[model samples]
Target: MKIFIIGITGRVGSLLARSLQDRGDTVSGLVRRPDQQSALQDAGIVAAVGDLTALTPEGLAELTGDVDALVFTAGAGGGTAEQTTAIDFGGVVTAIAAADLRGIRRFGLVSAFPEAWRERHLGAGFEHYMDMKKHADQALTHSDLDWIILRPAVLLDEAGTGRIALGPAELHGDVPRQDVADTMAELLHEPQITRQILELNHGGTPVAEAVQAAVRR
Candidate 1:
């Protein structure tokens, strides 16, 4: 599979790129800075240097052309509402449009749980983040593509356990960044898991079994 990751420089995004490459997929990323290119290349990921917020749909389509799938893990992180909206919400909108134009049919996004549910647990400081994610998820849901939205709880830096609880709609508790990457990699090849919104956290269900169950359900 030839895959392109939007924020390949991010923690989850970088890890995901490496994970996909380790499994022999040709992976590329849309990077903003030249400095970030070496890191991606070191991990065997092709870097297409460009800013998501600056690219036109035609430019984006050109960059993503011939890729089999796209993984979006970008986030603005504690910036103002406007900044978050531009990168998280606006970036996704552009990528989806580009992917549609380029005929890339599969998309995987790392999103957050519902704002109402998350606010109850994590509390405050997340208004804009949640709002942006909500809109981004909605855009993908309404697009003409096979999409998988993985809403993981607070991401931890701990190593992956190769097991996760993937619920159809909502789940609570922290999940390791590595586990999230692993799960998304699995979903890339899973065309049967189309148009599903799933939540992930540390649990006993094996990743493959959980994904299969989600599709079957």
Candidate 2:
């Protein structure tokens, strides 16, 4: 399978790209700067250098390079408020349009748990972040493409356990970034997983097993 990813340089994004590549899938990503191209090229991945904020749906679609699917993991990353909304929310909108324009039918989104605002409020900035994620997820959910929205709990950089609870279970505990990447890699490659919004957390079930279980659900 050939796949294109947004934010392929990020922690979870890089892991997902590696997992897909290890499985012999072609992976490509959009890099905003020319200097970032070398890293992806070093890894044997295709790099389409462009800023998400500036790309029209038509232009972005052209960069997809006739790939099979798109996974979006880009975030504001503590940028200014406007940048937060533009990247987090606006990027998804552009991606959706790009997918539609290109006739790409599958998409996966990396989002936060719904209880984010309720759990704690850092400030208006956080509230805005949650709002963007919420709307982005919603936008994809309502789009024509087959979509899987993975809402993971607190993200941990710790090594993956290869286990997770992936479903509508009550959200609890932190999940290693690797586990999330593994789960998403499977979901993107497997057609049987179906379309749904799954909540993820560290758990006893193996990552692949959890995904298979989601199909059974």
Candidate 3:
């Protein structure tokens, strides 16, 4: 499959890209600088140089053309408030539009758990981040596409256990970043698991089994 990732430079995004490439899929990513493009090319990814925050839907569609699937793993950390909205909320809007235009229906979004930030006193940045994530998830749900929203709990940088708790569960606990990417990779192969919102955490269930369990439920 030809897979295009929006945030291929991020933690989960980098892992997801590698996983997809390891499995023999054609992977492409939106890269901002020449250095990133060179690095991704060295790692066997087709790097499309462009900024989603600056691109219109038409422009984004052009970059994502001929791809079999699209996965969004971008976050708003370290950017300004406007960039946060652009990368989080606006990015989804453009991707949905671009996908619709290009006749690409499969989309996978990496989002934060709803309750992960709601029941806390996180600062304005976090609050805004959650708001945009919620809106992005909503946009995907309303679109005419085969979309899967994975809301992983607080992401950890620890090594993966190859297992995760995945389903429509209450938001709690922290999941390793590799596990989330591994689960998303598993999800790309399970197209039958469409239009669902799933929560992810570190657990005893293998990634494939966890994804299959969600499909069964």
Q: Give TM-scores for every candidate, taking all chains together and pairing residue i with residue i.
A: 0.93, 0.96, 0.96
Alpha-carbon RMSD of each model: 1.9, 1.2, 1.3
lDDT of 2 by residue, 98-196 (tens): 999998888999999877546665888888888899999889988989888999988899999998998866466689999889989988877876678
- Which ranges in model 2 have alpha carbons more than 4 Å from their true place? none
Q: Candidate 2, TM-score vs. the true structure? A: 0.96
lDDT (Cα, tens digit) per residue for candidate 1, span 54-73: 89878988987698998899
* Runs off by more than 4 Å, candidate 1: 115-125
Off by over 4 Å in 3: 117-120
* Model 3 Cα lDDT, one tens digit per residue, 19-122: 88878888998888989999999988888889888888889899987988999998777577798899899989998999888888899999998778566787
> Better model by TM-score, 1 or 2?
2
Candidate achieving the largest lDDT: 3
Total colliding residue pairs, candidate 2 = 0
